[model samples]
Target chain A: MKQKNKKVNYSKWGYIFILPFFLTFFIFSFIPLVDTIRYSFFQYFRSGLKWIGPNFVGLENYKSLLQSDMLRYAGNTFILWIIGFVPQIVISLLLASWFVDARLKIKGQQFFKVVIYMPNLIMASAFAMLFFALFSLKGPINSILISWGVITETTPIDFMGTALGTRSLVGVMNFLMWFGNTTIMLMAAIMGISPDIFEASEIDGCNSFQRFFRITLPLIRPILAYTLITSIIGGLQMFDVPQILTNGAGSPNRTSYTLIMFLNDHLKSKNYGMAGALSVYLFVVSGILCYITYKITNDDDPDGSKAAARKRKKMERRMK
Target chain B: MESKGYNRFRVIFAHVLLIILSFLCLFFFYILIVNATRPHAEIQKGFSILPGGYLVTNFKNMISDGTYPIVSGVINSIIVAGCSAALCTYFSALTAYGLYAYDFKLKKVAFTFIMAILVMPTQVTAMGFLRLITKMNMDDTLFPLIIPSIASPAVFYFMYSYLQSSLPLSLVEAARIDGSREFRTFNQIVLPIMKPAMAVQAIFTFVGSWNNYFVPALVLETKSKMTVPVIIALLRGADYMNRDMGKMYMMIATAILPIIVVYLFLSKYIIAGVALGGVKG
Candidate 1:
């Protein structure tokens, strides 16, 4: 009984230590999330003062979201995600593989790592301005392209105006912004593999490429899956680059407008109901995509599963 | 002998490819710095590798007339980032200590809640959060920008994992037996040992807050209250055609300076933190 009391006292102190986070999380995160969903179903009126009253719209906002221009915005977001995320992962893996290769024998590899990582720290607004300077019709890139006679005076690249043009712009920006960070993460995962595996592969006369494909890729599959899912989720929700570069209207016929941008506009226009519905839509879509990605990438290790089952059976025997 | 020759050729090819890619990466940054120095006309006309003499003039123009409230924005950015980092570090550390020390029935549930919120993008609650701020009469203030970020679940998740690995329960028990209160034990005992984790969290929180554009843009409408990123956005928009090119370059340079300075100082912490955070997440 005395020991029980002491244990309770210890737990009480633990609770006391954690109370601040719980208080703040409840007030800031959980409450706002609940309020967001709740207010989506109501009519928010602002005649005298803002008031949220239950109107039982019965999925009116969600229904309207489906029929609204949001579908177009969603399509744009999907395109951006593919352009941004797919190439990002590929480039990252390629770079990581190259960095790990023995033949490169690169000096100051850490210096290169730092240089690539620096861009990710820059503000999106600054990056946008930098790109605007670089990609403008009269900018140096165009001048260089023209000087090389790649295009005649009659033809100029309108990088920020056309669908393909904006996609390329954002794609490049996303790649530059993300590739370094992804490379570092992948490098860490690669480094985690036991050196004995490499020795074994070499003993078997496996070449570097073959060893990487067979041993390295398979061993780091979980990490790759993790990176892919997070990148997809982040890419789908991209806003700052498009918002800043396109002046908040999503550039050249809204070709660059992501779903988040669309949602922001709805909120700014005081269509809170629609904004809430859109948020819910993004949440659901991202959740579903994450699920699908997890399912597709999941690998079943037969030996590992059998080992786990044997360990469980042994534990049960000890308990008995 | 033929295979040896082939291997040598492959090695050379790999090094050449790597060198080219490295140069490509360096070229973009070179463009940024060169553009910062050159006159807008020269920049528009063609690439110039050497530094020009327009940097001081640009700096003066940017300080005098640029849309960004450069000095005040810097101060506001520092305050917001500094306060948010301190608050987030303390709260997250405290939560992590509690969760790890106790064997409560709701431990799994509480942890799941933290993980769930970590993945939920702030955009999902932006509208409601905005309304909540307006209702509290806190709109357009730096308070809204700083206070809400203090409850970052990502930081809590980091702290949780860090505490599990680095902290032991014996220290807490010893402090308790010495008649130290829970808060005192945490402040005096736990915090000192958690410096590595704290440094990483602080750097991440500071850089994140410093680079944040969306929440600040939405919440702070007043020019005086604008954060650095928001000010940079405004400068980019304030007459792109007839804009003071010198001032524009200066604003861009100023906007990037703080982050670069901080990153230079805290890069070691940043890298370690990123590595650790990546492991658990």
Candidate 2:
């Protein structure tokens, strides 16, 4: 804590307070992040007890990384997000707007909130495994599809076998898992918007949709940007869904293999150099996205920080 | 202008749409629970809408299966999740209080560094970190799982934001004026005030650690040492248990019960949190 009256430097306490976090981060997170970059440059092999080499390969690993399916894997991951988050955002926004609209007396709001958000509480891998069994050829889904004459009993469709099938299944899971959280977040944003804005828009003869697009959307842009960027970053780290759904195979010709899955494959196969390169690739891509998010959201912050600085300034002004 | 009848129709339509969506949201869980109670052969006969009488049988089978060691998996999960949640929350809050309460030169840089780590994909650092753990001979131990969570950027960010909104610096200054030690003040005074934030973060961290299969799958070599998700994976692969799909569904249900219970007990706080919203923001 600070004292306005005490002028001598007491920042040592600040350093002490924050030491555990930094020390732990230094050992576990920062070092590994640096190691990922460092390990990317060297070629290595397993040889008995002693490792054969982490000899300087320079950009050799990077060069070969370009030739891999990583770019495609990244694309597939984006496609999955597009499929998943589009419906997610649309539904969440709609639900949120309705709840925010007072005229729409949506009863049982609390119940629906709990029910919808329930799925997010469980492990993604557990859900994936549940779906894996549920969609098996002899399982309930295929049996029903056959009964409904959607497909023949003779050749049951392999839901996890084809690329599109696998992607769609994962997409559906993602959509289901996320939409509620998105709804809650959007609702929160709407709640934060002053009620007067909505009333003014209504008085100006703006319809519900117009008010939503012109007023609510514009004001909540920061939140929207935050969600989108985080989702993009999270989409890149999609591992548990595809990994478990395909039983670690990344099947259907690895179409469901995300960037993490691809790197995990490298990790599993002990191709340390190649895995390191992929890790760096992922880090760079995510860093760029984070930077873009930072720039977009902090455009108005003269200090080049976010709202925290502004809030602190306000606090300081209040104290004065 | 639209007629009153048309407005009524529109409102009704929206309600129906939401109702259907909620049902769809809950449908999978319904099936999973139902399937858990159905006999393995009955499960093969395609989807049935209601519960069957096989839950006890499935539970017994799970317990009796010498190969799976599911009880140990549950215990292991509780230990890992519980420890990680406590360490992550207390230390994160302590660190956040550090930044929030104090004035320091490198404060901004430290804050930025934490934010960077927030978005920095764990997959990027996972390999090197794993190697370090193995080198330290910490592989296959819960220490590796529980220890690193103290540096959780996401949790730190949450605590930082919570402290920003809730904790007034005047209180800290008052405590200091009374000659309360810095760490003691944090532990006794600030921590009690941070209960709601801690509870929310604790549930999140606990569920996340409990559900985490990736790192555990990598480090744990022995079956006895594995968590529930990994053991579920084992059961799925075991050809003998393949016939016991009911057991599989039952196991999944059992694994998630603690999470569901926590959710039920603390969902009001969580909904409040949902409204407050998000580590990234």
> Against the true structure, whose DockQ is highest?
2
Score each candidate by Cα lDDT. Answer: 0.76, 0.83
User: Candidate 1's error at A248, in angstroms?
Assistant: 1.9
* TM-score for each predicted model, relative to the true structure: 0.90, 0.92
Tens digit of per-residue lDDT, candidate 1, span A45-137? 343455555476868888877887888987888787788777778867877776776655666676666766667787877787767767777
lDDT of 1 at B67: 57
Q: Put down candidate 2 lDDT per residue, B1-281, tens digits, no spaces.
A: 33568668768988898899888877777888998898898887778887999989989998887788888899999999999999999999989998888888899999877776666777788888878888889988888889988888878877888888888988987898898888889999999999998998898899889999778887787988999888877755563335678988888888776688779788888877777764234
* Best-fitting candidate, scored by lDDT: 2
lDDT of 2 at A131: 84
TM-score of chain A of each: 0.85, 0.88
List the candidate 1 regions with Cα displacement exceeding 4 Å: A1-8, A43-55, A101-104, A152-155, A287-320, B1-14, B40-46
